[model samples]
Target: MIHVVFEKANVEALRKSFELDPSMDGEIAEVQDDFAVGPLADVDTEEGAAARLQWWKDILAGGHNEGLADDGHVDDQKVVRELKAKLDENPEEIVWIWAAQNKHDVSGYYWLMSQLTEYQGRIYILYLNNLPFINEKGNIFYPTNLFQIQPKEFVKAKKLARVITPSEFEVDPDEWTKLCNEDKGVRQLEGGKKLVSRGYDYYDNELLKFVTKEWQKGNKLLQQYFSKSKEITGDSYLLWRLKYLVEVGKIEMQGDWRNMKDFQVRLPGTNAEAAETTSAEASQS
Candidate 1:
């Protein structure tokens, strides 16, 4: 177990690079050099000097997660805008984004002024993938990765790298597209390929097909569904529609939704009860 706290000075000093948790203000007073907190050679050597030193190093390195000044990261538009300018001037100045194991990626750039403590002169950035996500009936939709990253330039970089949206950096959508339609088999995060030619088993296909079908049915309806699922599809209509279709055998499933095959879909049975509910949802949406 490791414990570390970021100092107020650190947060205030590097507010440009990222946002700080307000909770850390009262807890930590000042920043301690990695060496100062590293190991207390003269203190009780319960863990021994070597172990303690290493522990200090771990604290410094891991302190970012613990709210250390050097570990501050954020997706602030202002900071990103500055970075965008810097990148525009000198893309080569950027070395690497602040990447951590199992942590969100934070992009970094070189600086001579040392405005940001964490990214003062080296890599400085947090991976930003937060787009206004719209989740409707498990099918998540958003304004596109293009709109996710701030300043918009980041989106260009991602496209050039052929990286998928945040959670799916390494996925090769192009390759996945080839697997199924050899055209639309694009991939999702973790190398998850989406296909239409008997692609992605049944459940995945069903979800994709359902979404695609909705899109194809009518652009107006699709817009309504995405802009507000509860409004257009009704609060419970989408779920009940799915149930109705599944129960009636209009859509067959070999297994779970993620792994299904040979399925068809049908609309829900609309009665006074269902109509009233859907009407209410539509009005709200």
Candidate 2:
């Protein structure tokens, strides 16, 4: 009975709209298990939740990120038309917005959110980076479909907006976060880094392949190793582990894995700094 365009998720607008007609309160929400199938808990268990999270991570990698940004087609009018055509109903304004997968790709999905959320009941979002990202701050930088990095504060604000309107995809925020936290582990992806941390070795054998290779090639002191984490673009878990090691002083700044601020190089290393860095780099590889 209620139609919603989730693009401009401003509470003020909703308040005005509701005041105008209380019966017509609704919103187009990000695509989530709850949105399509009623509720996450009703149909998805912890294991199902974990599998869902893992699927999200795989799709949000850089290659997919860039591809969607440049080529994603978000014709709001067209979406509006399509929705009317598909649902066979036309109730009100259509919201448009892009939804990123994770906090990592929020910056990348800002512009897309606007263009996509421009229709009624069209929660158009791409599942990149394993988390949905669309927000007011995203509106600022990605104001007119421009691509660039926005801050986390902006994302938080958009989240609030969606919360009030209640994305058809709504769930217990704490429960959702818990699911994300647990599923977002080192082994979620295939053949990236072999996490050797305590109680976190989903891909222990795979991790050994790369780490042992480096060790055989003559590296040492492989504590807290991360040789097979994720395969996403610059956001790979291996790369993150490398940065983490550097932050903790497990490695220095030179050799095959020189810790240039660039931090994208991957080569062999004999020194401890290079060895650790190299190991980190190998995780992504």
Candidate 3:
């Protein structure tokens, strides 16, 4: 059996689970790239793929996530091609796709399973949607991502695996195609494999709520937003949007704007000197 997961952290979690139960051991492959956010116009076509890559390039050009390369989606395509080849080489080999309840995992599920329709019966899914699992502390809780589950809990999760039905194989791909054609910047999980499309600035107002009249460091502001906001997105994308907010004069920026830690942001017409003095006093205290 070959296991496919969406997040990189999930790859390690599965490895740990394999160690706990040797019988469930299999090769694990991660589908990189968060399809929850970004342009998905004709993503299956070569021109659309190039356009998507360029979009990522523009987002990363803002100097967020310096470690990530621009060719991740391209690499992911290669990974999928290799997975298909492996399946072709061995008909007995079955695939297991693990996903948890969240737009990131669900969107990735739609993108990946659409490509594996040819392998219909051989592909299985373990969707832990709204399912209760015991964490490290033995508390029962619902998880939003696969990485959040304890390795031991995965042994139980394996029971949730079900073969991709013929109906789903036919319907899910159409859903993906519809999403691609819609060309929306954001795909939100409404519930149970249903996605709602939204514009690129979907999170802009939420981001703005975090911005105050008093200057706040970019990194600190992002931390507060991630901790407080119910809607979560990539920090790189949020940073890019923050810069856009600055460009349009919705927010004021100071210091080196290229790096999050090196810059500070506030609402328009804020007292810069007083803000700096307050920051210095807080640091001294």
Best by TM-score: 3
lDDT, candidate 2, 1-285, per-residue tens: 223332333223333434445443454432211121111221134564444444334433332233332233433334434544544455444443443332222322221233233342444332223223345544433222112223343333233333212342332233333333444333122111111112222333333334421322212322224333442223233333443444555433334332223223222344666678889999989
**Candidate 1 per-residue lDDT over residues 1-285, each given as its tens digit:** 001112223333322222233321221112122211122232123344345444433433421222332333421333444644565576454423321111111101111112233233333233223334333344434432222223223322322222113323223323322332331211122211221222112222233344422112222323435564321212122333343445655543222222112232323332545779999999999
Candidate 2: lDDT of 251?
38
Q: Provide the TM-score for each candidate, comma-separated.
A: 0.19, 0.24, 0.92
Question: Which parts of model 3 are misplaced by more than 4 Å?
Answer: 71-74, 272-285
Model 2 TM-score, 2 decimals:
0.24
Q: Residues 1-285, candidate 3, lDDT per residue (tens digit)?
A: 999999889999888998888988999998888899998988877888778777888887857565365545446788789899999999899999999889999989999999888998999999988999998888999998888988899988999999999999999999998988887799899878899899999999999999999989999999999999999899888988988999999999888757888999999867876789899999999
Clashing residue pairs in all predictions, respectively, total: 23, 32, 0
Task: Report how far off residue 84 is in candidate 2 (Å).
Answer: 22
As a whole number from 0 to 100, the lDDT of residue 269 in candidate 3 is 69
